[model samples]
Target chain A: MAEWVEACAAEDIDEEDVVRFDHAGRTYAIYRSPDDEFFVTDGLCTHEKVHLADGLVMDDIIECPKHNGRFNYKTGEAKGAPVCVNLKTYPARVEDGRVMVELD
Target chain B: MNETLPGMVIIGAGECGARAAFALREEGYAGPVTLIGAERHLPYERPPLSKDALAAEAPGIRTIAEADRFEAADIRLMLSCEVAAIDRAARAVRLGDGTALPYSRLLLATGARPRRLPPAEGSKHCLYLRTHDDAGEIARRLRPDARILIIGGGFIGLELAAAARLRGSAVTVLETQSRLLARAVPANIAEIVQAEHERQGVRVLLNAGILELGERGGAAVFRIDQPGNDAGSGPTEIEADTVIVGIGAVPNVELAEAAGLAVDNGICVDACLRTADRAIFAAGDCCSFPLEIYGGRRVRLEAWRNAQEQGALAARNMLETDEAHASVPWFWSDQYGLTLQIAGLPDEGAAVVRRDLGEGAFILFHLAADGRLVAASGIGPGNAVARDIRLAEMLIARRAAPAADKLAAAETKLKSLLAA
Candidate 1:
C-alpha cells in the first residue's frame, strides 16, 4: 500500500538545500530545488550510510559528507567512483504549505 | 587486441591500484587487467582501521570491492603475490614464484609502509598498524584492563587513542612536538582536538621524547625525557600493556629505484603520472607528481581521496588520454564526536580569516600573501563543517580572492562566494 506522509513545511528547506525527515522509523532527505520543486530520497548515503541531509547540495546532486560520494537526489543516480550503488528516491509533492512524500 | 598482449598490469592492489584496474575497464579498455596484491586479503580500505574497525565488537576488513565485482569486470585479482623485479626492457614483471608476466603498461602503486622505531623493533608488546592484520592485533590488545600508549600525536596516533578510549582502555599519547597535529593543522584547531581527547579520558603528553622502548615484565615500557624537568632528574619511565607506534610512513620506492626509475621522496612522475619511461606510471602514495593547481608544485598525497582520484587519473593516462593532476589536497580526521577537515596546504597562507558557526564550529580560511584563498581548516561536531570546507576547496582551486569580511561573516554563504 502507498501512503503519503507530511515531511515538513515547504519553507523549512531553503532553495538548493536539503533537510532530514523521519517517518515510521525511516529516514528521508527532503530537497527544495532552486526552482521551488520538492524532491526526496533515502536519508543515508549508499556509500557509507551517512546522513545525506548533512551533505552539500548543488543543482540536483548531493555530495556525501564523509567521502564525497555524489548522487542525483531527483533521479537517484550515483555520479561516480567510491559510489556505485544508486540511492532510492520517493515521490514528493508540495500540498498547500506542507511537503508530502509518498511512502511504499 | 593482440592475443599475446598481457594488457594492463597493476603492481599494488590497495585503494589506488584496485581503483585503477576497474577504471581501466570503465574507460572501455577491453584489454586484460591483472591486479596484484602482497596482502593475503582482497583490497580493503585503510582509513577505517583506526576508526570503526578498532571500535567494532568484532573487527573485520572493509574491502573496496568484492570478489564478484572483480570477476564481473574481468579483473584478474591476484592476492598474496609478490613481484620480485621489473624487467623494464622486456616489459614484464617477474613474481617471487619465478613466473614472468608481460604487460603493455605497468603501474607501480606499491604504496607506503609504517616507519619503524628501532627500539620497538623486536618488542613483543609493541605494534604498528598499516594493514588489516595489524589492526586486528591492535584491536585485540585494546582491552578494558589494558594500558595503551600511543607514540606520535599525528592523525593515526590520535585516532588510535580515541578508539582505545572507546574500548575502555586507558590511553596516553606521546609527542615530541609542543602541540598535537603540528605538521598539518593550525594550533587553534589542534588545541580543540587535544581538548576533546582529554575530555574523553585520553592523556595527551606533548614535548615528550622517547628515550627507549623495550619490554619489561611482559609489558611495553618507554623511557621519556621532558625539557622542563630538572637537569639531574634524568629520564622517567612509563609502562603500558601495549604500545602502538604511529610515527609516520615511508614510500616503498626501493623497488622503483632499483628498477632504474627516478626516485625522490617517492617514485618521480610527470603531471600525467607517467614515469620517465613511457611504458610505466605510478600513483597513490608511491608516486610524487606535479600538482597543476599549485603552479605545478610536485607533491605526494597519502589521503584516501587522492589515492582514488589519482588511480582513476592514472588509468585514463594509461589509456592514452592526457590529464594533469589538478585537484586540491583535502584531509579529514575524526576523534570522539568531533571531526577536523583541512583543504589545501595551510602553509601557503599568510593570513587567516575565521568564520564561526553555532555550537562551537568554526572555519579558518587561509589566504596567500596576494589575498587569494589557499586553504580552509575546520573542526566541529559531526558534519558541521563539511559543506563549507568543500566549497572552500573549490574556491582554493579557482584561486579566488574572497573578501575577508565576507569570509568571516556567518551570514555569507560559502556557496555564494563560489559564484563570485
Candidate 2:
C-alpha cells in the first residue's frame, strides 16, 4: 500500500534548510534546496545514524552533522568519505501549499 | 585502445590511491592504470580502524573501491608488492621482486608509518595500531576486564580508549604533554575532550612520562614518572593486559628522499601537487604541498578529505591541465558519541568567537587579524556544527569579512551572510 501524507506547510521549511517529519512511527528529513527544490531522505546519516535533518543543506547535497559526510538529497547518493552507503530518499512533492512525501 | 593510452602508475593502494585511480577514469582519462599496494588486501578506509575495527564490531575491508569497481574501471591492482626504489632516470619504479613498472606519470601515495617505542621501553605485549592487521590483533586481545594502557592522548589514543571502554575494558591514557591533543587543538578545546573522556570512565593522565615497559605476572606494566605528583615521587608502576602505543606517525618519505626528491616533513610538492620532477607527483600523508591559502606554508594533512582531494588534483595536474588546488582542509574525529570537526587552519593568535547552541552544543569561529574567517570548530551533539564549518570554509576561501556581531548571533543563518 502506498500513502502520501502532508509533511508540512510549504513555507514551514525555509530555503536551504531541512525539517524533521514523523509519519506514523517513521522519521524523514524534508529538505528545501537553495533553488526552492524539495527533497526527502532517511532522517539519519548512514555513517553513524545521526539525524540528517539537523545537517546543512547546500544546493542539493546535505552535509551530515556527524563527521561532515555528504549525501545528494535528491538521489540519496553519498558524496564523500567516512560515508559509504547511500541514503534512502523518499518521493517528495509540493501540492497546493503543502509538502507531501510518499511512503510505502 | 588501452595500449594506446598513457600508463599511470600509483604507488599506494590506500584511500588516496584508490580515489585517484577512480578519479582518473571519471575525469575522462583513457589510460592504462596500474595501482600498486604493499598491503595484501585491496584498498580500504583507514579511519574506522581505530573505531569499529578496534572494538571487534566489523572485521573486513572497509573499501573505497570494491573489486568490481576496479574491474569495471579496468584499474589493475598489484597487491603485497614492495617498491624498492623510484628509478627516475628510467621513468619507472623497481619493486623488491625486481619488477620494474614503467609509467609516463607516477603518483606516490606511500602514506605513513606509526612511530614505535624503542624495544627497551616496549614489552612483548606492546602493540601499535596502524594497519588492518594491527587493529585485528588489538581487537582479539581487548577482552572484557582487560586493562588497556593507551600511550598518547591524540586522536588514535582517544578513539582506542572509547572503543576499549565500550568493550568493558579499563582504559588508562597517558600523555607526556600537559594537556590532551595539545599539538592538534587549542587548549580550551582540549579541556572539553579531556573532560569527555574522563566522564566516560577513561583515566587520562597528562604530563606523565613513561620510564619503561615490561612484562610481569602475565601482564604488561608501564613504569611512569610524573614531574610534580607525589604518587610519582620516584617511579610509578601501572599494569595492564596490553600496552597500545598511539604516539604518532612518521611520513613514509624514504623512497622520495632516496630518489633525491625535495623532502622536508614529507615529499615536497608545489601547489599543483607536482614534485620536483614534472613526471612525478605526490599526495596524501606522504607529501607536503604548498598551502596557497596560508601564504604557501607547506602542510602535510593526514586527514582523509585532504588525501582524496590532493590525490585527485595530482592526477589532474599530471594530465596536462594544472589547476591550482585550493580547498579548506577539513577533518573529523568520533569518540564516545561526540563528533569533533574542524575546517580551515586555525591561525595562531586568531580571535575566537563562541556560540552555545545549548545542551552542550557549541561552535567556535576563529577570525584573523584582518577580520576574515580563518577556521571553525564544531563540538556539538551529532555534529550539529558542521554547517557552521562549511560556511566558515566558504568565507575563508572568499576572504570575506563579515561583521563580528553577525558571526556570533544565534539567529543569523551562516549562509545568509554570504548574500552580502
Please write out the lDDT profile of model 2 over residues B30-78, one tens digit for every residue.
8799999999988988988888777674466577767897999899899
RMSD of 1: 1.6
Worst 10 residues of 1 chain B by lDDT: B227-236
Clashing pairs in 1: none
What TM-score, over all chains together, does every model reach? 0.97, 0.94
Categorize the docking of model 2.
medium
lDDT of 2 by residue, A1-104 (tens): 87898999989999989988888887889999888989889898888688888778878889886567899999999986667789998898999989989987
Q: Which portions of model 2 miss their true places by more than 4 Å? A: A35-37, A44-50, A66-71, A75-88, A94-97, B1-6, B119-122, B230-235
TM-score of candidate 2 to 2 decimals: 0.94
